[model samples]
Target chain A: MMRNMQRPMDAMGRDELRLWIQQLQFTMRDLALYLDTHPEDANAHRCYLDALQRWKQALAAYKERFGIQFQEQVCDHTDWSAWVSTPWPWEKGEN
Target chain B: MWQYQKALQYPVKIKQPNAKLAKMVITQLGGPDGELGASMRYLNQRYTMPLRELSGLLTDIGTEELSHMEIVSALVYQLTKGLTPEQLEAQGFAPYFVDHTTGIYPVAASGVPFSAEVFQSTGDAIADLHEDLGAEQKARKTYDNILRLADDPDVRDVIRFLRAREIVHYQRFGEGMRLLQDKLAASSPWPKNPYAFNPSFDHECWKHKGRKEK
Candidate 1:
């Protein structure tokens, strides 16, 4: 089962990727919504900071388990090809 | 400081998948105006942004696109499961099976793997913002197409959610773009960042000490 897991940036076997993404997604969503209503909420602002930190941690874990990767290149040249050199998104063990 | 609500983080709880719908969504996955490109464009473009709110918007929205990719994959996985060869040939999924074998891939709906040329970071604020606007519209249209093409109620529900999110993202980016355009006339207080995501001026508390550029 572990052998089958091969996708990068998604962190195989942890199942943390999906849940973490969902959590952060929800965090930002609610933050956006509430901040809309209560722009002055100091607590919400602090939460945003914490949420962003959590988000970075999730990104780090994903990068650590899989490798640093990007969805697209800003530089026209793939001169920084190393970023895209890893496995593709559909490879097994990546879910 | 961005406080978060746990419930809204990953509100999509189901793991439903539909093949035809998946195919259309893949257009946004690997297609020119797809989610992958949008995500990449915004995430990478943030470094050069002059505003805090706009940068935050890009980071959050770009990150959400990653989930959109996963949602499509989940749908594809559910749709392609337990298929027979005959079904494969009839449904036009055979060629893909040969390449990926029921796997979720970052390919165009036509079956090509993702390409790096999908997104751009020109470093010019007006150009990138225009691109962001167009990108959101393209994604919205793709979702609209998915809504038209998908027959399954399950798939339609998710498509509706996805479609709505695109509109929201468009509004967010549009607002951020306007904010930048207005700020351009003033002296560059936060550096001439074309990718800054904050449309709101509340970055004083949310920004990190080390990460703050100015």
Candidate 2:
């Protein structure tokens, strides 16, 4: 039940939303590694699926509000400048 | 086949520029037990793995190592950013500054460039898995050493994350080794001697016997 609780994404700021998306991404990545070795683990598989779904939603929200994080997401928008103008991950106060 | 992701796997926003710390952390990027070597080792070795699961594990872990490489590069970049030449000289970063000028070049803190000699891709599954296990411990130990010398909380926080990943990878590789052994044990004529032959190279013999059994 606790796992099912959703964060209020609409009320969150840009940085907060980005951090939430990162947490979800980390969950998905760790779960994927576990599932790779324990292919038959139903619970882990379930968690992976949930994380993936949340990650997609969070990423979409982030992209629509901020900008695309990957080249593949470029097709969703016409302005390529938004992709280039944003600060890179290594830059201070960017990521 | 890998696509570029504009964001880092983890965030790195080091406030203070410490050239000295950057020198030490650069080792994780290009040192003997660095993430670059770790990625190359697993990716290359995956080709010769006897089992699908082992190959998949290698691919996933190897991909993660690439992200780790980026994280290290970002750490080094932030650590060395915006330092004056005099400040760099005083911090013992002059040698690296002369060559790279704050550019993220893959070289050990000792100035040795990265080399393929850091890892091996033996066609033998047992040997390769052992190499991976050893590699993970070595990387973890290097992170421990960095943690010992590094004083900045910001740098250490990222280092700790990278160090923890090595432990997880070690566990996965251990599982992968066990999976390989079980498969080899079942397929071997001498069930007690799984090491009797290289499953990667002797696939024809295994296939013929497997076909006969069917």
Candidate 3:
């Protein structure tokens, strides 16, 4: 029998890693917006919790394997730092 | 209704603490025209606004102000770190260190704690927007003061980004003002509008119905 072919989470590269973070941010923002209208939406509250978990896990995996760009706790600098010299959307005129 | 989570918005990496400058930043955090004020002003003003778009803008901007509060708090955190007794005596952080050791307390850099007076909610859109625009300008001035006082380029970059946000917010509120003006005039009664040459007072002109309608 043929099995479902799912791309593994570990298969994601740097750009994919960045996209994962973006997805987490989008979901978080959506939850925030949704809650404004449906403050008591239990399903929505559940989704918020789920997204937070996904973000935490994904960030941990990304930092362990490829290293972090967006977070401070995952930095490599002897001093506190981020690899900001690399291009990001704000500098690329995407903002 | 938004929940507060600590923001790691953009990674702010400061090499060393400058206790003096951190003190000033805290003043607005706790003082009038501080982030607490800015955030509350917009959030509270949102409920009374007749237009949905303006209300959305207020909520979005108010949310951003929360992030701004986090950013300044981070700066204060970084600035107040690693103060030994010797450094405290030398840099004039003795009083502050005595009170709070690296705990993020909202205070004016002048040492005042965060307070409700930092913001106003007048319950009128025009009055609120007027206050909002002025608030942005005041925030920009605070950034200017930060630039003048701060020697660290890292700190300056954050201050600059924050200053630019105040301008962007000002532009947005200005756009909001234009929209509100249009709505007010459109809501005005058409026939009595002496200023119908300019369509602004169309709806509002009717309210002075103290004069009998022609």
lDDT of each: 0.62, 0.85, 0.67
**For every candidate, what is the interface RMSD in angstroms?**
8.6, 1.4, 9.5
Q: Pick the candidate with the highest TM-score.
A: 2
| Model 3 CA deviation exceeding 4 Å by range | A1-95, B3-7, B190-214
Model 2 CA lDDT for position A51: 82
Q: Roughly what TM-score does model 2 have, to 2 decimal places?
A: 0.93
Model 3: lDDT equals: 0.67
Ranking by DockQ: 2, 1, 3
**What is the TM-score of each predicted model, taking all chains together?**
0.61, 0.93, 0.65
Tens digit per residue, CA lDDT, model 1, A1-95: 21233244344444556456545646666477445434578988888777777666666675556544433221444524645564443333332
List, residue by residue over B1-214, the lDDT tens digit for candidate 3.
6653323444456777887777776755666667777888898888877567678878987887877777777777777777777776677777777777767777776777777777777656777778899999998998898788888887898788788878878887887777665555545555334433322213344354444433
- TM-score values for chain B across all models: 0.77, 0.94, 0.84
Candidate 1 similarity to native, TM-score? 0.61
The true-versus-predicted C-alpha distance at residue A34 of model 3, in Å, is 19
Q: Which stretches of candidate 1 lie over 4 Å from their true place?
A: A1-27, A33-95, B1-18, B188-214
* Fnat per model, in the order shown: 0.07, 0.74, 0.00
Error of 2 at B208 (Å): 9.0
DockQ numbers for every candidate?
0.06, 0.72, 0.06
Backbone clash pairs in model 1 (N, Cα, C under 3 Å; residues 3+ apart or in different chains), count:
34
TM-score of chain A of 2: 0.80
Tell how far residue B48 is off in model 2, in angstroms. 1.4
